[model samples]
Target: MTDLHAPAHPGASGTPVPAVPEQPGTAGTPGTPARDAVPAEKTGEPKRNRRRVRIDHLRHVVVEVREHAGYRTVVRHAAYTAGGARLLTRRAWDSRTTARHERMMRAAEAAGNEELVRQWEQRAYAYRFARHRRRVELLQMAINAPKAIGYATATGVGTLLILGFLITLGTGDTSDLLTPIEAVVDFVGWVSFLASVIWEPALYSLPLIALGAAWTVGRRQHTAPAWALPADAEDRDVVPDEGAIIKALSNLGIAPLNKAIKDGWQPRWVSPTTRSGPGWHTQLQLPMGVTVEMVNGKKKVLAHNLLRKPVEVWPTEPPKLPGTLDLWVADQGSLSGPTPPWPLLTEGTVDYFKGVPVAVSQRGEPIMGKLMAANWMVGGIMGSGKSSLVIALLLGAILDPLVDVEAYVMAYNVDYDPLKPRLRALVKGDEDEQIEAAVHALRRLRDEVTERGKLLEELGGDNTKLTRELAQKDPRMRPKVVVFDECHELFMHKEHGKEAAELAVKVMKKARKTGITLVWVTVSPTADSIPRDVTRNTSHRVAFAVGDHVANDGLLGSGKHKAGVTATTLIPGEDVGTAVTVGFTNKPFEVIRSHYVAREAEKGVDEVTPVVKRALKAYKVGDVWEVPETAAADVLTDVAAVLGDEPRMLTQEVLHRLAERNPSAYLEWGPTDLKAALEPYGAEQYKSGGKSMVSRTRIQEAILDRLAEADEDEGDPEI
Candidate 1:
């Protein structure tokens, strides 16, 4: 029995021999018969099993634990506690000493601001004096403690005794004196018993409370390191605070700025943080050797440090403050969001002399620029919102009936179809004929400028420029605005390019004072695309997104790129309708996001068609100032007619009513125009309920005065 399936053991020579099992088909051989053979597969053992699998499994478990959310949160909170303690200690130290004042004084001295240095020195001295006086008072109080306590105890005991005597008299009993003292002893004993009951629990909770407070401070201040913080922590839209701003500036890699910060340079806040429009605005005085230009150049880096996108942070120079940085930070994703609707879309009118609301500043304030007495050069690549901005300006113009808006779009699209009714002359298409028409329009504008100048001289006014009254009274002197979209086609045309450039230049130079505005727009901005003479004479320059610096400077101005006023920083598709504009603000340059007016029809809604219809109606009726001689009457009469039975009307409402009554005569009338009309009769607009109101009674009285004057003139003719 031990013979068949037994393994061979080591022999005397210590050599091992292998044992072989019976083959599958040879079950019943003579020497090896088939016993009940057990299969190796049924044993459930792997032939290649080794120790490496266990090691791998352990490593995977370790990784899972490390990656768990619960673990991360625990580590983050621990870090927060540590960081908060350090911050609180530093703050406590600064409060106890003159560290803040001393730091500001050093910064001021480095900036060569002696006045600020002296001011900080005075403040530090005052703080020291105040602190010293407080310390002396504390010392005196400590010295008088024991005597004061003794007096208080004696007085309290005597009062209690007197009360007890009073009580005894009332009770008329001998033992009543001890009753009050016994009650007092009971009260103290009860208080001690309560304290003993609460003491242990309170002691245990105090440390936890302290730890919770530390965590709160750290969480609010974002004190955890980046790795420990939540994955989306950096994406949070945190408003820029003083510490964040200082940290960003300090890390800008400017040697001088970094050095100054290391030497305790803190921002001298010219203005505290205040909500401006849709963002936060503050003015900071940079440390010495840190110019506004330097800060402007590092806008992307600064924005990143503040946990914001590059488009969300805007840094500019405060006028007349050389070292000052005017900073504004928008709410996260706000710039990418849709802007507010145009004010004129629902109800509003434009006064060409005052200005038109075209775009909004990065801070979300309305940006107004004068359309009269100015020339604009606008440039951007295709799909960069060049045409949209021009459309915004044109929309403002049509609201005023006196302004005749003419547009010649070379690369014709249906974007301008809604405005066709209001446009005086609309030329579309990029053909040679279209190019010639644009040039011809420029030629006519140039001639008109010359004729208007001569007319202004003939009027015999001391003022050389056209005035509102003069223009309103004489229809020929009315304001004219000409827009040339895709103007490069005309400016670079072989046949008419030279004449177009010359005529545009002439009109821009002379027509500013003559009440003509030229808006030159182009997708291609080059010396050949936009003539040098045109860019030279243009007063206002707006540059949208462009591919390179040369194109940016071509529209903004030469040397503008080097000066840190560049449009190249603008994102292409994401920043449509956003532009860098000069001559709009007093600063070197400003970024404006133009109000979006949908050009293509969307969901059967059209923004431009209705407005254009209104403009068309007003224009066809003609200027309100042009009343026929047979109907010749004073402005008082017109006001009375518009006022009807209403006792008082808002000045703006009156203007609208006047336009409605006689679009021919009052279509161009504005607040100033109405005021000027009323001034002659010693009648003026007044505010009622915080709104500009015109009284009907005042209009009636002014009419009577005009009638009386007319009678006088007729009756007193000399022989």
Candidate 2:
């Protein structure tokens, strides 16, 4: 018998006879042997030994094949281990595997490894063929086993029943065998009858049918376009689908949102709603450790993930709940337009001490702010409606019957001309006089703060703050609002910049308790323009479009932009009057659109002028009163007038006379106060015969020096 597992070589032959080798065509190349063949030299061994060797070799081959197949199976099953069993059921597995094979084949070819490339191509073909064969087998098995059995059973039962009927017809015998069949038929007939009886009520329920039809129609109507457009015109303004949005958000791998959905944290998605105007609204019930502020801080990233503009995607919280995120996505790229007109002021009626409506919120509700005990800082880029917002705030205070309005416009604009007449002090220009006037106003406000401080201390209850009761008792203590428009001009002045900034910081710190409100507006919101101390003390901040985060934080407080009250996303000309305001509403930060206050035709006055005039008439002693052109000039002359026929006078006596002349202006004057006020102008108090006194000569010299400087400023070619 031929040995199947023999070594193809002669054994123990001294002559060394050459054995016939297998043909290279059948065995492989000349250097290689057939995998299943053995050498012929070992054929002389015992049959039993040869048989044992062949069995052991076969067992080894089987083990190796099994091990290789097991490795492949483990590799294929890894997908299930990583992403769950759903991956195995999806057709994506086949496509992904095919793509991977193609990539590997291309890489192998690029590396010039022909053998590796061929091997990969063969493996890919084998895998695809095996997958197809297995799928076919499963499908055939599914089709043949239960379905064929069921069909055969059904056919047999029908034939038996038909045969029984025929047998009864032919034999005409009602026996026990037929009785069981008869009972079954009767049972089936009864079941059909009951089923029909149950269905009868459904046929007559017209109300339910009508209600369902109505609901379907209503749903269709609700989803229909609100306005008609020509065919073939793309409607880019359509709201995005909520399901698609949620899926996209999930794909972004946002930790809070994804973890909530995966870990059964009760993640609930709400249907998107429409805003009052042109925005889409949606809410998400945030998981633990997730807050609206957290989401808002990542607004730019979220916008990129959603493939939308940053300005179009706004994330906020419901006014009361921080855990519920309210996302507003504008249909238009910009959240501008449909701004309501400014409300008409009610003469002698509006009370602004508590709050006044300045703008409308995203939800169309009015946004109100309290001017009492509050200081405002408004900042934005040029043409960002900074002036309009300032006017809106001023209109609120100006319409109130008990408030005094003082505006200093350093960078003069025509917008303020209408309200000029009603202003107790209106200083507008970029000239030296204007700069000096603004500085003088700040100094006077500082003095007034000191006087009010003294009055509050005498009252003794919460002495730092002036209460409404005190204001009611003394009308002079009513709200005094000072607006500095284009205030950067004052801080940029070479001569007075440092002193002006210092005085502003002091006023912001000390004025809140004395019924004084400072509203400062600037186009350049920077550390150089707005001092840190002034920015920090101001409680109310409004920031429209700005250049960058630095400007945003300078206007709004430090780290406020990171906290998600960012105005940098706003576009200057596009967003117009839209702004992010803090301390205006119950929310930490709100996006507001101020109303447009149109300018009036008569007297170059705007809608705000008449309101301010009415407010001044109702509050001030006369129809109109002029403020001193310069506090320094007026103080010098007033002191000289009080010192008439006397070379020197006690500081106390001068303060007493000044207080009598203007009690509200000088109620807290003291020797130190007099010296500090006069020191800026090169005047000094001295000891004259055991009493501290001021010299008229020194006061006159200081006045002349200031006048000379003013004259030089007027003569300069730059002016």
Most TM-score-accurate candidate? 1
Instruction: Please list the residue runs of candidate 1 whose C-alpha ends up more than 4 Å from where it truly belongs after superposition.
Output: 1-237, 255-275, 282-297, 600-603, 621-719
RMSD values for the candidates in order, in angstroms, are: 18.5, 30.5
Model 2: residue 240 alpha-carbon error in angstroms:
6.9
The backbone clash count of each candidate, in order, is 4, 7
- How well does candidate 1 match the true structure, expressed as C-alpha RMSD? 18.5
The superposed Cα distance between candidate 2 and the true structure at residue 437, in angstroms, equals 1.7
TM-score of each: 0.60, 0.51
Query: What TM-score, to 2 decimals, does candidate 2 have?
Result: 0.51
What lDDT does candidate 1 reach at residue 80? 81
Residue-by-residue lDDT tens digits, candidate 2, 1-719: 22445443211211111223333222433233234445434545455554554544444344334336454354323422333323333336656467656766765565355766775687687678777998999999988989889998798667767777777777788463365467777988999999899887977786567555544543322222111112343323245445334544554556776555444444454323434335667666678866767676677776765667677777766544457666776665545665766554443234545556677776555566668889999999888887777777777776655567898999767777777766678888988899999999999999988888888877755555776567665666767899888888898899998999999989888887788999889889999888888888888899999999999999988877766678998877888888888877656777888877767743555577667666556544663332212233267777777777776777767876664343324544666677888888877677654356888788888889989999999999962
lDDT of 1 at 112: 60
Q: Which residue segments of model 2 deviate by more than 4 Å?
A: 1-245, 251-309, 316-334, 345-348, 459-464, 467-469, 600-606, 616-719
